[model samples]
Target: MKYVVGLLLALACLQAQATEEQTVVLISIDGFRHDYIELHGAPNIAKIAEQGVRSEGLIPVYPSKTFPNHISIVTGQYPSNHGIVDNNFYDTERKQRYKMGDGVKDSTWLTTLPIWNLAEFQGVKAATFFWPESEARINGRTPSYYFNYSTPAPNRQRIDQIVEWLKLPEAARPRLVTGYFSIVDTMGHRFGPESHQVAKAVKHVDELIGELWQRIHDETEVPVNLILVSDHGMSQITAKDMIDVKELNIDEELFEIVNASTRLMIYPKEDVSADQIQQLEQRLKQKQGNFVIESEQQLAQLGVTDGPRKPAIVLGTTAPATFTTRPEEQRKDGGTHGFHSSRDMDGLFVAAGPAIQQGTQINRFSNIHIYPFMAKLLELELMTEIDGDAEVLTPIIR
Candidate 1:
């Protein structure tokens, strides 16, 4: 009788330890600029900063687009390394085109393994609610539970779903969960970041965040780690600021404009002459002093290089000015990102849990570092090499 009782107590302690080691929730708020917490009085977000850890600012990877940065956060790799260099790009080598709205279901595009892969491989259940690349099976493995991305799911609905997932039995519950909210980015694009619409959107997100916080505290006895992150920041722009590249009337046969607007990347035709390339450069910069042409050496700063799919001549513009080939693609009063990383367009990062340091503030940190930080919290071993260094995030975590 004494031996049986001792065995029962040991089993209970082991189960409790497992539960504590496996509770991590990763939430992404699209376009969550670091200033929004103060600009909009984001109380719920502020709470995390006050009680847990908050970075002074979280710098995004270059190009600072949605999909790329989000994927980078989880994969611990740069967009160039992961192969999702832009929200939309034409793969010259594979003859494949990747567009954001259209389903990017193919996993071959990803060059590194994501956090979900590690979780699943270690027998830890993982779930995702609209995180980029969550729906696709990378290396024949997807999150244990993932929702298909569509038009933004209701914020309350997403929070409710997460709460339900947390309430499940330990064996079935997700040890690592990822979620997304696009309202801030949507409002930022429709109206400028300073507009009242953006404030309202920020408030809405704050409420949803509060709801999640309350639910987690109320429902879970297992120690939970909550991490809220954003892909990039937004910059105000206008239709009048857009430089019409088509006005140059350059021959489309000589090069294909792979991506444009804010940043322009062009792939030259195989047989294009050096003179033609120079002419194309002259035409692109004909009237724009805001354009800064990027060289192969400069592209390395953004973790990219010149390749068949990569633009031979990369053009970056100042805030409020952009390059676009489509005349109709204009916004009278809106916001945009994907500018140079030096523009100070940093995202937000807040974390709270047993592993996170309380009332700690990191002056600034890179988004790629979040991957190894998360892996450590969940006790999962990363199986692939990545760009992130675990040592950089040591200050933020216990």
Candidate 2:
């Protein structure tokens, strides 16, 4: 009888230990600049930084676009390695184009495993609330719980769902959760990053985050770690700074060109002769205005090595100027991103919870490092090769 009693007590202690295991919730605030917390007055985010860890800045991967940087953060690989080279690109192998906001169902484009997929594979249940590509069944698996990417979903509801998931029975709960909010990015693009609209959006998102932080602390016994990040920052630009591609006088039929606002990707037609391509490149170099043409070597430096999606020639602007295909596409006064090596492209990073050291400040680091850090926090094995070095962030871990 005494042995039976002892066994029951031991089992109860083990169950308690299981319930107390750390939970990590990664939140992405699209286009949340590193300075927004201070410049826009996000008291809640500031509070998190004070109580936990903050970075001088989070350096986004090259081109610094939304989809690529977000994938980089979770996959710990560059866009070239992960195969999401840009938000929109032509996949020559697939003979199809990838468009942003298209609800891509095919997982063939993703060459690397994201952290959520990794967690689910290793018996650690994961959940997501509108993370990019989270809806897709990658590797024949999806997060245990997830919502399709919907711009109209209320932020409050997303927070409520996260809380509910955390409150689930230990065996059923997700150890990792991802949430995304895009109001800041939208407002930044419509009205410049420094505009009143962006400030208001920042305040609104901060309030939601405050509510999330409070609920996690008060509603559950599980130790929850909250990590906040952004894909990239924004830069103000005007129509007067637009570079019209038509002005270059290139024959449109000879090449496939994608004008990505901040950069222009030029892919020569298969039948176009090498001499013709060289002549076109020469013409672009001579006519290049505020933008600079990027060479193969330069592209490789940006982690855009040779690939089918890799453009034959890239024209990258120096900011305050962007490439535009049509006159109507130019904005009078708004914001844009995707500039390589621009400080304005730096994003935000703030983390607070049981696994992170309190009141810590680290220098700028690339977003790729985040994947390994989160994997460590979740106590998952690093099962794949990645560009991020876990040691870069090990010092901030408690």
TM-score (C-alpha) between model 2 and the true structure: 0.93
Off by over 4 Å in 1: 1-19, 101-103, 273-275, 282-288, 325-331
Per-residue lDDT of candidate 2, residues 328-388 (tens digit): 6534778988988566888999999876788999998999999999998888898889999
Over the stretch 291-393, how does candidate 1's per-residue lDDT look in tens digits? 7787768789778865545766778887898776555653475898888774347999999876678898887788999999889888878888888998888
TM for every model, in the order presented, reads 0.91, 0.93
C-alpha positional error of residue 190 in candidate 2 after TM-score superposition, expressed in Å: 0.8
lDDT of each: 0.82, 0.88
